[model samples]
Target: MFCFLRKLHKMESTWPHSLQFLLFFSLLFSMAFSKSVIEPCNSSTSCNSLLSYLLPSDMKLAEISTKFNINPIELVGSNNLDQQTSQTLILSAKTTIKIPIQCPCINGIRQSVSTLYTVQPIDTIESICTGFGNLVSPDQIKAANDLDNSSSSLESGQSLKIPLPCTCFNNTDNGVTALYLSYVVREGDSLDSIAGAYGTTVTDLVGVNKLGSPSIDPGDILAIPISACSSANMNLYNDSLLVPNGGYALTAGNCIFCSCGPRNLSLHCVPSALSASCPNLQCKGNNLFIGDVEEELMGTGCNVTTCLYRGYVNHKVLSSLSNTYRAQCTSNHSNPLSPSLPPSSIGIPSVHVLPSLAPAAAAPFAGHGFGSGPTAVQIASSATVSTRTSNSAPFILVFLLALMLVFIPFDPNVYS
Candidate 1:
């Protein structure tokens, strides 16, 4: 019995030691297997924030996780990677790895306007109230605005505030001031002419005035606007040029016919406005938009004929820039009087004209001389600017990618 009990005690003690050894060895084996099982990220920068060393060919996910003091699952999630539950985890080796992130908007979202209305001219209580007869009356307008009973004679430049039909007036402050302008009616004014003068469409006038016929008569009090031409031309000149379209009027400036000092002379064919298209072509009755400028900038000092010709030539040059990309080519010589170029010869466009304006080119202003240098430079610079604008998108993307590479982190043990 003593020997058997002694043997039993020995067996029990050996069993405990065996269990301890099995547990310790199992843990060691598990760690070793883990070091060789997991794969590395495709890109070195992927999950680099959690990695302590660069990924090696032999190292695995478990080894990287231990070295970085991070969970293997966390590392995969951070890198936007898929975790493989199977024994074989093969990762793609690529120079770039795509991780979808919400891109920030470079341009703000656009919103639609709830209501849109245009400015009108010298709106009187009666005329404005007529548009919204149901909601307001002329009497009410005169009373609310403390106007005289004879509201028909409103000032030419005054803006009249009114409301649209069917729109609710939530409060007394709902009314807003709208633009009003002056328009002149000639003997042969048509609906189209009147609308063009006012910068409003026929449909808008018809809708507002509810007219039955398209015809307008002379001496009619039509609301129109003083064109930007008058303002722009005036600004360019130290003095103002307020000539009417197709009518001759004395403008306060140097004469187009004589180099004599500033005088009052009439100009024909919308003298206040500059030509928008090539000169020599008939004026299409559109006002020249000479925005607010000073008098000194107004005079090109050239005669009307030369200015018109140069205007047409300018149109031709602008059209070329609009149509073609940067390329080496020769152009035919253009007509001195028009934009039409001469026939091609010897594969090289012949050079013509002394870049300077001729003495009789136009009424030359004092101290005003034309140089071809700035004109040529402007043409080349314009072409370059257009080219850069066209290729800006691709350049932006490449720049962003370069920035990403520069900022991204890299660790040797990341993929190990």
Candidate 2:
């Protein structure tokens, strides 16, 4: 009887330890397979951040959960799969799957940074979000914009803000670190100027932006890599080294000079005085003429004299950098006499001109010989008349043909 009692007591003692071991491993297993929780946006309760993933082939629910470190049950519920449980079920091939992305939250509000995106023609919210790797959900976008429904259409040229997940890099403190700033390229900006202004190199800018070439168009938003020099440190005159050639710099609270040079090569500054003397000329009623000017500017200098005789007058002066002056020129007289002057004589060299104008348009006073209002206005009026005549040629031809047909006798006999 004593032996039996002893054996029973020993079993009771071991029972507690067995239970403890099981509980300990249960905690560990839960921790190992735990998934990130989707946070709510500050403004809306329905907003949930998500990421889209394209499956290469058909995969089982359990397999996907395991691969992405998500709970099988949660995955099934979130995706609305037909499966009732977290069992092995095959999902269709090429299926776009939505995975919940974790976002930083403060006081129950998500802290996500966003940038503006201009909607292009035929662009849908789903398509735009998908293009961005699904870092944001359709619902989140709708909530951010306060749209009535997700099915609402977007018009071309409309802008939308897109949110992105913030990541904390552990090695940022010790390694080469850079902060990104959003910049819009203006009419006179070049990659070299942008890099110099921000205290970074053109190579880094191109790499970060993934630009096919150094050329950038107006209204293009560039992700500028800024390592040092904030808004307070920008100085134009004394900091000539920081200003790109053909690009302007701010000095004494004003933008001064034009930094210009060869594309993708070293640049030099052109005196504002010389640039002012260069004529603004555009070919009347000819987009082709403007294209020629752009092409020539890309090469060496503007053929001011030839362009002037072609009825090209500058409408507006864009910027004078290096030896080239970019302007909107127009001429009233169409088919003007072409001059026999050599190309060299027509093209103004950078060395002959003097620098004077400050880059800032709002500068207190104009530079020496900067403003030429009456002459410019007279040229523009003449150019407008010529442009109108050229534009009406096709209409005139059509009208003349119609009149001829009305006067002619019936052509039924010819058809027979």
Candidate 3:
């Protein structure tokens, strides 16, 4: 009886140990299965058989959806804390995220936002568009922007507007359909040269032409899209562009360190100072600012008023610029930068500095003769004289008729 009781006690002890072993194996199996299904999430909450992970830099919603065997919208919406809400999210390398056990929202899903990007070196249109979350297809990008689907190369510094996948699913169909315009290739035209000229990508031209070679012959007409022109074809020195100071560097269609020029000054197109096509110093656009200064000189005691007017003419030309140079120049006041001259000798053109040697009535047009043209007041006077002559001529005629009737005989009898 004692031996049998001892055996039973040993068996009971082994049973407790056996139970612990089973529990340990069960937990291990569960962890292994979970690892296969979901990525490891850092949050402490026990996984309800689901997993989550930090997004890789190259990961996109479309790609992630395919990999996880779930809907792209569903996966992105739930996993994205910052993206789910409209609030800004800072996603640095070490940011932690919680992967929910169940999908959060039923009806709504994350959408994509369109983006604009500039082309960089060694970039292909196909690679660039696809690399950025497959937001824009090569065919769609080509079609929307009027690029040739044949080539897929891009030039450095050319900007492209890309559609991005974000929570906001802007029905991209509502966006403007871009058109591609064609330009005849001129002499010395390369694919890159043409792209630069039209502000398009070489890949676009290659896609359009289906050209295997980079060498482009003159007279090869290329199709370019309006977006390319609008975003990429920025010219800082275009005659139409305003130049503020003597020099300006244009980047992304905006000017830096520049000022506005006179309105009427004719802009001369020139090669870009920074770019290959940027205008030289002799180009009309280059002189836009200097021409403005020259015009303002007329108002500020300089005798030049015929300069062109742009947006900033009135401010620079009409108002006297505060003299930067306090010391006077020459006894005759010819040179602008002479030192030894007196404060009284410091002269501006015809402004307050120069007293009129001529009479007050003829003060403005004094040296200027009649053939040169009438002064502003003279022109006004001529207009008044013409109006009075028109009004008094009729009265004079009637008065002359009355005098004739008084002096001469009446002719009524002859008519009868």
Candidate 4:
């Protein structure tokens, strides 16, 4: 410690004031690196999950949605915003948002496969690490990118691989379709408080994580379960899905889109009128298209038949017809038959990692059906934003060091 103090004294005299500040700040902050969130994946069944993203700068919802390849509607609804919230609205920097992704076991770990970050001139490895709310580790980033100690500077425009935290514990929890979110534990966050915010129970959480005790620490990643409006996809190409209760999923090679609502836990699938050319979506002899419905009142109630999206097969859309009770007009059905629940232990498809459990039960969700977009849910934010911060830490340390360098003379003789 004394030798380091003497080195600081020498640098203080030789370096100018500005250099002194920069050097001291970098040295102090770089000493302590943040820990990575921990959740392992060993299951074959894949499911949807959420990644808590801290915005690096002011950005529009549409741009972010496009960057993540998600429907604008799902992005808005996931944040508990109005379905009609303009895509161009600029959200502030430092605001944390949940990003839904498919988490499958990749080489023994559960993580979404392909999230990339482009280097900027002003970005140091430390800044990039903090930009992700410290959920990402500097060492992980360096290991993934094969980077050296020169993190203070980097070649602009180079892409960096981000190994995000996520899970898919068989996509069901306590016998219902679920979405799992990788939530980082925070200080002052009791287990019950975390459970209550997302409308789940502490027992379910403890069981899902296979914990021996209820104790948790900051930076630990817990697989949080969220009940989803279930999917009954026929597994046409391994693209099975179950959307988080207010979110949307684009499937069938973008020819079909699905959304889930709080009304009865059904997945509403439809022909997305986006520029992609879809296969013939007509219900033969029924004068209907995917998501289209026809209703006739029976003696006691209503008899409804609708066209549904099953899955994409051989580049052809697989759809079927149902003659069941009046389904909330899809323009979608079914609390999908439950997959055999895996033993509770561990954990996306944003395809939902966590939910505000659901939205308030509303009118039978008569959806946009064709082009405008799916209905939004008034569900609350499911993942908790991390409370860790250190923007002023470097400055504070540098200030204190400056005082020590001048006022406290180093005793080289005593050290010798």
TM-scores of the models, in the order given: 0.17, 0.21, 0.18, 0.60
lDDT for predicted candidate 4 compared with the true structure = 0.58
Tens digit of per-residue lDDT, candidate 3, span 1-416: 23432443445444453453354345333322210000112232221111222333433445444433444333332332212231223333222221212212112322121235667797777566434423334554564456765566677998675522121111010121122333333345566654554334565445433444555433233333222011112232322332211112122121111211112112322111222221212214323221222222322354322122222221221112222332322233333221222222322111111111111211111011122332222222211100001112344446544543443334444346
Misplaced by over 4 Å in model 1 are 1-200, 206-220, 225-228, 231-235, 252-254, 257-331, 338-416
> For residues 343-387, could you state the per-residue lDDT of candidate 4 as single tens digits?
121012222122221112111122212223211110111222222
Number of the top-ranking candidate, with TM-score as the measure: 4
The backbone clash count of each candidate, in order, is 33, 28, 39, 16
| TM-score result, candidate 1 | 0.17
Span of ten consecutive residues with least summed lDDT in model 2: 382-391
Report the error of model 1 at residue 75, Å: 85
Global lDDT of model 1: 0.26
Q: Tens-digit lDDT track for model 2 on 1-416?
A: 23432443445444453453354345333322211112233433222233334444567767666544555533442343432232645655545444433334444444343356778998887677545534445555676677766255888998776654322121011122222333434457677776665555566555444455666654344544322111222222223222221222222211112222213212222212213243332344433211132223223333232221111123342222112343422342222233333222332222211121111221111111222223222211211100001222345446544543443333344446
TM-score ranking, high to low: 4, 2, 3, 1
Instruction: Report, for every candidate in turn, its global Cα lDDT versus the true structure.
Output: 0.26, 0.37, 0.30, 0.58
Q: Roughly what TM-score does model 2 have, to 2 decimal places?
A: 0.21
What's model 2's overall lDDT?
A: 0.37
Instruction: Tell me the TM-score of model 3.
Output: 0.18
| Predicted candidate 1, C-alpha RMSD | 36.6
Error of 4 at 220 (Å): 3.9
Over 4 Å off, model 4: 1-47, 62-87, 148-158, 186-188, 209-218, 233-239, 252-255, 273-281, 292-302, 313-318, 325-416
